[model samples]
Target: MKTRKKANFFPRFHKLFAVKKIFSLLFAGGAAGAVNGLFGGGGGMIALPALERAGYPVRAAHATALAVVLPASLVSAAVYFFGGVPLAVLLPVSLGVTAGGLLGAALLPRLREGLLSVLFSLLMFAAGIRMLLP
Candidate 1:
């Protein structure tokens, strides 16, 4: 009979901070930040998959991607503000995004993993198509 080794949470967690892992994470984060800064959004298009590839579970990946992008988004918004992008133009979309974020958070836990994965893939596909079209 083959025996499976028990997973140790601390060791697994500690391994996440190893030098190579840290370098990979930094590279991914830099790419996401650059994309966000250049495009005004879409950091998650890079971040979520990066996090997943780094061994985060789907839910954790999504949550961590949000955390990773928030500061980049904030900095980009600040730059836009300095560049005189009008607040009036942003207010409505910001409000909608805030509401949608709240709703999505409330629903995330109840969503099936398969459904979430499919939806995420569809979103990425749509974004890629849109980018390629114009």
Candidate 2:
């Protein structure tokens, strides 16, 4: 009987952190944090690809990106709160986001990799085009 070595899905995480890779990851994370702080969104756009390039599988990368961005999002929200952005204005949007997140989580496991990639690309492209428009 032949035995196959189990693949390490996050190889970069398992090994000793190299200085170059550490800098690259930090740069990516810093950029994502800055974007989140400035725009109140879009951090996942920068983090997902960075994590994927660092050897995470697409699903793992997406999940990890959420974890990575959560703290930044919280801090950004805190700033907005202190800046007197009305909590009532955010309440409805927050409810919708929570519902959508539940639906997305339920669908993620059943989604095909190709379909997910195409959807993600289209979303990013649409966001870019929208941002570019007057």
Candidate 3:
């Protein structure tokens, strides 16, 4: 039986363009953080692709993105809360969102990578179209 080897927590680079890789990583990280802070979510959308490009498997990338998004989300929520964004809306939405998040997290591991990619692409495309509409 063939065994799968675990990926390193930090990926190791071979004799490649190290400087460019570092710069790309820096840019991606900055963009993810900025998007999460400004939009109050979506770091994961930016982060998923960046992690995939950095050689993480799809499942790992998605999980890592949730880890990345969590703190950014908290900080943004705090800012909005203090800035007087209506807290009332949060109560209703948070319940559904929490349940949905749990369901999605539970389903992630069971999904095939190809199906997951297609679903994510469709979601991004739909979001883009929604933004372009009136």
Clashes of each: 0, 0, 0
* Residues 16-119 of candidate 3: C-alpha lDDT, one tens digit per residue: 54556668877887899899888777888898898899887978988998888888788887887898856588778989999999999899789897988899
lDDT of 2 by residue, 50-125 (tens): 9998888988999999999999999998998898866687899889999999999899789897988899999999
Give model 2's TM-score versus the native structure: 0.73
Top-TM-score candidate index: 2
Summing lDDT over every window of 10 consecutive residues in candidate 2, give the lowest-scoring window.
1-10
- Model 2, C-alpha of 104: deviation from truth (Å): 1.5
Query: Please, what is the TM-score per model?
Result: 0.68, 0.73, 0.68
Where does candidate 3 stray beyond 4 Å?
A: 1-17, 108-120
What residue pairs clash in candidate 1, if any at all? none
Q: Write the per-residue lDDT of candidate 1 for residues 1-134, one digit (tens) a residue.
A: 12223224446655657556778889999999999999988898899988898888988999999999999999998888898866787899889999999999899789897988899999999989999995
